[model samples]
Target chain A: EADIYQTPRYLVIGTGKKITLECSQTMGHDKMYWYQQDPGMELHLIHYSYGVNSTEKGDLSSESTVSRIRTEHFPLTLESARPSHTSQYLCASSDFYEQYFGPGTRLTVT
Target chain B: AQSVAQPEDQVNVAEGNPLTVKCTYSVSGNPYLFWYVQYPNRGLQFLLKYITGDNLVKGSYGFEAEFNKSQTSFHLKKPSALVSDSALYFCAVRDGEVVNFNKFYFGSGTKLNVKP
Candidate 1:
């Protein structure tokens, strides 16, 4: 099945710990996006990549940084995690008007 | 930049009754709109999309959406509501035309509740 996958479906980390969220898609889409959403809230675009080596920040300011060394892989890393970073992170890939989303990673920072 | 608006935070409907979720968009060029649905603790599933031509687009799970260019809206509608239809719905829009890439913007999302 062609789909997007996100690793570590749920994670709990202490503040200041370093962590990276992984996202990969089997579909050869050029556009990949990362969105942050609180429980029962709207999703905010935090980061996105058009293609390999072409990542850009989205509407929301994020402490996390993303790198797209390969087309299928887009990883978001936080040098130092914080309490405010606790939220659900969603990964998506788009071919045209439609976008496919992953199951999402829910993080809880203590 | 393209933008999407889903005015309601929540919509309640009864089983077997028709339901509608409103959405509006703003873009400089022709609009390519889409609808996605999310269940509790799961990924969002693509419900439908409107690219061009047809005013009404049918999609997964007996769901459909009507695109109105003059009104700048693409509202999701279902003939009969079900308890399973209770989920978060999001409307999205992308910039159209050759110069525009596949950049998508989504609405805040609306929660639909179907009471049995």
Candidate 2:
């Protein structure tokens, strides 16, 4: 079955530490997205990609950057983590309209 | 820009009772709307979508939504709520001519509580 996956379900890191969140999809979708969400709040789009070698920032400005080197993979990296960056990160993939989401990664920056 | 709005911050319903969560949207052209549910500490799961043709769309977990063009609303509903249905719900919209679907904009979710 086609699915999206995210690694490191939970992460606790100190401020200024650099970290990367991994996301992959076996669905072969060309468009991928990354979103930040707080409990019971609106999810903010932080990054998106049209396809391999193409990436763009989403509506919300993010301190993290993303790279789409392969069609199945997209990774987000924070140069220097901060306490404020602590939030749930979700990875999603879509072919046209509806999106499929991964389990998500909960990051806590101390 | 296309946008989605969920008016109620929270909705409470007794188990086996009907449930409704309101959603509204704004867009420039034709709109494609969707609903998703999130369980605690989990990712958003697609419940249903309204692309065209029908005013009412049925989805997973016995949930349904009505697309009211005049109202620009797509409210989620279930004939009988279940305790397991308690979760956060979000409504999203994509703006474009029917053929040109693109990025989506989401609403701030609504929390649903179904108690016995």
Candidate 3:
């Protein structure tokens, strides 16, 4: 099985609260990605990291920021949460062709 | 730009019958195709991939996909469908050429429903 892990599988918070979603992988992959998925919708790439100290924005624009200080970890932080930000966040690490996904974190903002 | 399209929003099939999910892609260079399945509230699992060589590639869970260069399609198929096979299916393509080849673009996803 893939060793990718995401903390806080489910979260609920009030608007304006800052939150961080943690993602870690034991696969030691160079490529890590963060995607946002809504109910019955296609997953949109939000942020990705090529490797340690390398970060880039994805096809979709997001208000969150990501950091890759360590090769195994890529964490995303939102300065202020809003209802529009409520969605399922997925973390994945790729080894060339195939990508291994985490269980995902479902965030709900009220 | 590289992109993937899964025309069907949903595909329904009867158990014990053959089933297929359609996918088409557009890429600048040769295509690196893949299929992933996701259960409800769960992460996606790698089912199969077509990197090169054989046009017909078999993957986990008795699933397979045939890559057609002429049609630019890679459709997932199963000889006999099972009710447990019902889930969301995604088709992905690796973008960029040999030089800057990075990023995997996924299709909109197709929901598969197998009826007993």
Most accurate candidate by TM-score = 3
Model 2 chain A poorest 10 in a row by lDDT:
A1-10
**For residues A4-88, could you state the per-residue lDDT of candidate 2 as single tens digits?**
9999999999999999999999989999999999866889999989899999898899999999999999999999999999999
Over the stretch B1-109, how does candidate 3's per-residue lDDT look in tens digits? 8899999999999999999999999999989999999898888899999999999999998999999999999999999999999999999998758754668899999
Better of 1 and 3 by TM-score: 3
Can you write out model 3's per-residue Cα lDDT over A6-29, one digit (the tens) per residue? 999999999999999999999989
Task: Please name the candidate that would achieve the greatest lDDT relative to the true structure.
Answer: 3
Query: For residues B35-83, what per-residue lDDT tens digits would candidate 1 score against the true structure?
Result: 9899988778898889888899999899999999889999999999999
Residues A1-110 of candidate 1 have per-residue lDDT tens digits of: 23899998999999999999999999999899999998767889899898999999988999999999999999999999999999999999988558899999999999
lDDT of 1 at B84: 95
TM-score of chain A of each: 0.97, 0.97, 0.98
Model 2: residues >4 Å from true position, as ranges?
B97-100
Docking class for model 2 is high
- For residue B76, give model 2's deviation from the true position in Å: 0.6
Q: Which pairs, if any, clash in model 3? A: none
The list of candidate 3 runs beyond 4 A from truth reads: none
